[model samples]
Target: MKRPKTKSLVVYGTIAAILLMFWISWAGGIVPQVWQVNALLQDDPMLQEYPYKFRAVLLASGVATMTRPYDMEVAPFDFLQVIEPDLAGKAPNDPAMVAALKRLRAHERRAARVAVSHTAADGVEWVLDRAWYHKHGIKLPPKTLVY
Candidate 1:
């Protein structure tokens, strides 16, 4: 019987190690753990925001799951219906719900602006405002996605 080459053995072992690391990271993602902690341990912010940020996180997680189907499940806003049937029809029209959504979107846009500004200052100038592009003679790229 011929012996396996050491080089091939080393390559296979390295590949296996990489796969194991990926699997472990996927299995141990922090989002679910955060949910569990907030739900069970009564974290004040998570409790007070009940179903707003929680719902947002769920939708975000669901979208993330779409990108990594094997590792995630899309348990989005509809899950709120399952858990709190009272919120189904009423939430859409509720002033508080609308205000919460607006607040969340504002927070997201503010964070995006801050990130773009920092990146631009750090020489990722392509993402900077059109004013910066014109100042530097870099043609502004057509807008793609907003956030």
Candidate 2:
């Protein structure tokens, strides 16, 4: 009887340990990264006015691993719904928020262009440049010219 009880205890302990590790990894790593991204976005003058929207976007982007400027082209509204459901519906009607969103989009586009230019020979740059071309309706020039 004691042996059976010991075996059950060991199994329960193993399951508990797994759960604890998952919680720790998420809370210690991902949560802090999300907060750091939010702080950075909040500090930006262009984004300061739209604190909630910025937070929503940052959290979603962090989860999606959307760290690159080109990755930000994903619509903020989708994330806003998850982060701040109450404000998501009203965002379209708010002129200030709309303007801020536009500014953020433009900034991301410029950043993506700069990143592509700086890393011209890299694989990442190749992908980013393709995206940039598609977004701006520009044709990709010859590979020789790209490098």
Candidate 3:
């Protein structure tokens, strides 16, 4: 059999490279968005307390994931609100929900302060503080969580 032409090989290689790049970009972008939404939803105290709402939010997230184009920019919370507006807003007029929200906010504030204080001086202290926060599930502020 005759060997393939150089032109054909170049065309095939270019197509393969394009496909690989697309796949890499799609996976890299979408996976983090999904994880971010999942984390935010799971860590929400109100969602945990309300099973139906949790299911609804998860379903909406899944739909958003499906409909979202590869590598498209999307704010996870914004997509969430498009599906269920209430999920993004303040809790309903329930005392327990309000208390839970307050507690979560307080925890977030404390974690932020601790992270700021430790990270201000040395890298070693920052690492140690991060490890402690993770071990304790302190849920450090979003910026601190990145390292």
Cα lDDT, model 2, residue 63:
34
* Predicted structure 1: lDDT: 0.38
TM-score of each: 0.28, 0.28, 0.23
Which model, 1 or 3, shows the larger TM-score? 1
- Candidate 3 lDDT over residue span 14-132, tens digit each: 99999998998785533443344445545666545532222111122223221120012322233223334455564444464455445444543333332223212111110122333
Per-residue lDDT tens digits for candidate 1, residues 70-109, read 1122222233343355556655547744654455445434
The 10-residue segment with the lowest total lDDT in model 1: 64-73
Clashes of 3: 0
Candidate 3 Cα errors over 4 Å, as ranges: 5-10, 19-93, 107-147
**Evaluated with TM-score, which candidate comes out highest?**
2
Candidate 1 vs candidate 2, lDDT winner: 2
Instruction: Assess each prediction's global lDDT (C-alpha) against the native.
Output: 0.38, 0.44, 0.38
In angstroms, what RMSD does candidate 3 have relative to the true structure?
Answer: 15.6
- Cα-lDDT of candidate 2: 0.44
Ranking by TM-score: 2, 1, 3
Candidates 2 and 3 compared by lDDT, better number: 2
